[model samples]
Target: MRFLIIGGSGFLGAELARQCSTARHEVAATYLTRPGETTGVEWLPLDVRRREDVAALIAAFRPEAVINTASRSADWTTTATGAVNVALATSATGGRLVHVSSDAVFSGAAIHYDETCVPDPITPYGAAKAAAETAVNAIAPTAVIARTSLIIGDGGSPHEALVHSLATGKGRGVLFTDDMRCPVHVADLAAALLELAASEYHGIHHVAGSDAVSRYELGRLIARRDGLDPDRLPSGRRADTNAPGPIDVRLECGMTQQRLRTTLRGARQFLA
Candidate 1:
């Protein structure tokens, strides 16, 4: 199987590239600035925001599957338009597409969302993700739009780094007790995505961890896993802050999990 991973330098993208490469799949990963350190992958320079560049690359590579993990939380062009470009190129090339989405697409008004739930985004980032989903679905109706939650890793994720920094007094920010998400390990997510890409499934799927945890509790779990003092991690309510996003959006992955071989481990299980 030949694979093209868009935004391959990112946290989730890198994991996807690594897993695919390890499986002896022909892998080509794109990067905006610099490529990742993963060996055995053909690293290529790409800016998903540019439609021409994206179309040219996909046409040239002619990958059997293209997994789009690219996103910029604040940039609508990078997050929304970029996804549209990828979808168009993949569809034109007749390649299978697995578009990674986010739980941010929800407004937290429902707290729990299934694969059938309609997006009601509140924040700019959420709106961008929702727009991306709509475009991908429209352009490539057979594509898999996988919506996942906070992607945690083995001390490599941003939230884990933040926990280490705050625990050691290198960073100054409170982990929100009110903000909750179903965190999935990077390995599990990447594997599940690859499985979906190789399978005959299409449409929106909820891919997230089984347990929902607060950011503060997640920080404590990270701190404990890294041998840091969990008590040193400051905690506060996101409702008290001026943060603009959902408070407790949890993706219900039971249906998707039933289709996946990869186990989406929760924060407590993975960190433990």
Candidate 2:
């Protein structure tokens, strides 16, 4: 299958691209700033914010599936509007689309946010992610909106640096005790996404790890795993801060697990 990974330059996107390439699939991954971490897959310059760029890529690759892992993350323009553009492009092809979404879409008001739960984002990043999911649904309802949790790997993900820095006392940050999430290994999530791409599964899918742990616990675990002193990790809560943050958004991923052959393990198992 011909696959296109948008924002392959990022943490998750690169992993997805790598997995597909290893599976002998023809893969093309896009990047905004620099070339992605993957080597086997074809690299292309893609900016999801630009319609012309997206249109041109679709015309060039004519992929069987387009997995949109692209995002400016906390930035609204690239994360929200950029997703809409990618969805439109995928719609133009009438191909299978797996739009990589985040669990941040929820406000953390509930415990079990199943696949059917309506998104109520709290933070700006969360709001952008929610909008991105909505845009994808509006543009291409057939697209698989896979909402995921914190992505971690074997101490290699770009997202892990902040935690490592704080654990070593190089950075100062408060780890959340009340804020809970399911952290999935990038490799596991990437594999599941590839499997979903091959399926006809549409609508929102909560693809996350099996373990639902707090941010503080996750930080301490990360610290211990990387040979850093876990005692340096400071614990706090979302309720204690004036800043906007989600409290608990643990996705009910049993439904997702039943659909795919791939197994999603917890951060504890993977990080260990």
Candidate 3:
């Protein structure tokens, strides 16, 4: 199978590329600023924000599957419009599209969300992700929109880095005890996404971890796993701050998990 991973330089995108390459699949990945270090992959420079560039690249590659993990939380043009561009290009090329979405789409009023839940975003980043989901669903009805939560890796992920920094007294920030999410392992997410791309399932799919944990608890877990003092990690309530986002958004992935071979390990299981 020929695979094309958009935003291959990103953490999740790079994991997808690495897995695809390791599986002996013909892989071509695009990077905005720099390409990933994944060997055996044909890296190409691409900015998904450019509609023409995305179309031309996808048309030329003509991959069997295109996994889009490109995201710019602060940039609506990159997160929403860029997704539209990728969807249009993938549709034109008749390729299987597996777009990675976020759990931020929810307002946390319900606290729990399934595949059927409608998006009611509060934050700008959440709104952008919701917009991307809408555009992708409209443009490519058959595409798999896998909505996930906070992605944690061995030691490379942002949250893990933060845990290390705070534990070592290098960073000055409190991990929110009220802010909750179902954190997923990067490897599991990438594998599940590949599985979904190869399957006939379409529309929205909630692909996230099984455990719902608070940011502070997650940080402590990371701290413990990395041989750091969990007590050194400061904690606070997100409600006390003016932070603009949902307090607790947990993605329910039971239905999607039944269809996937990869186990979405929770933060406790993976970090331990």
State the C-alpha lDDT per candidate.
Answer: 0.95, 0.87, 0.95
lDDT score, candidate 3: 0.95
| Tens-digit lDDT string for candidate 2 (1-272) | 99999988788888888888889899999988888767789999987888888988887889999999877655898989888888887788777899989888888878779999999987888899998888889899888999999899877775478788887788887888888899999988999999999998899999999999998899888888888888888888778898577788899898889999989999888878
TM-score of each: 0.99, 0.96, 0.99
**Model 2 off-target regions past 4 Å?**
none
Query: For candidate 1, what is the TM-score?
Result: 0.99
| Tens-digit lDDT string for candidate 3 (85-122) | 99999999899999999998999999989999999999
* lDDT digits (tens) for residues 1-272 of candidate 1: 99999999999999999998899999999999999999999999999999999999999999999999999988999999999999999999999999999999999999989999999999999999999999999999999999999999997899888998999999998999999999999999999999999999999998899889999999999998889999999999999988899999989988899998989888889889
Model 1 residue-pair collision total: 0
For model 3, which pairs clash? none
Candidate 1 yields a Cα-based lDDT of 0.95
Error of 1 at 150 (Å): 0.8
Q: Report lDDT (Cα) of residue 250, candidate 1.
A: 89
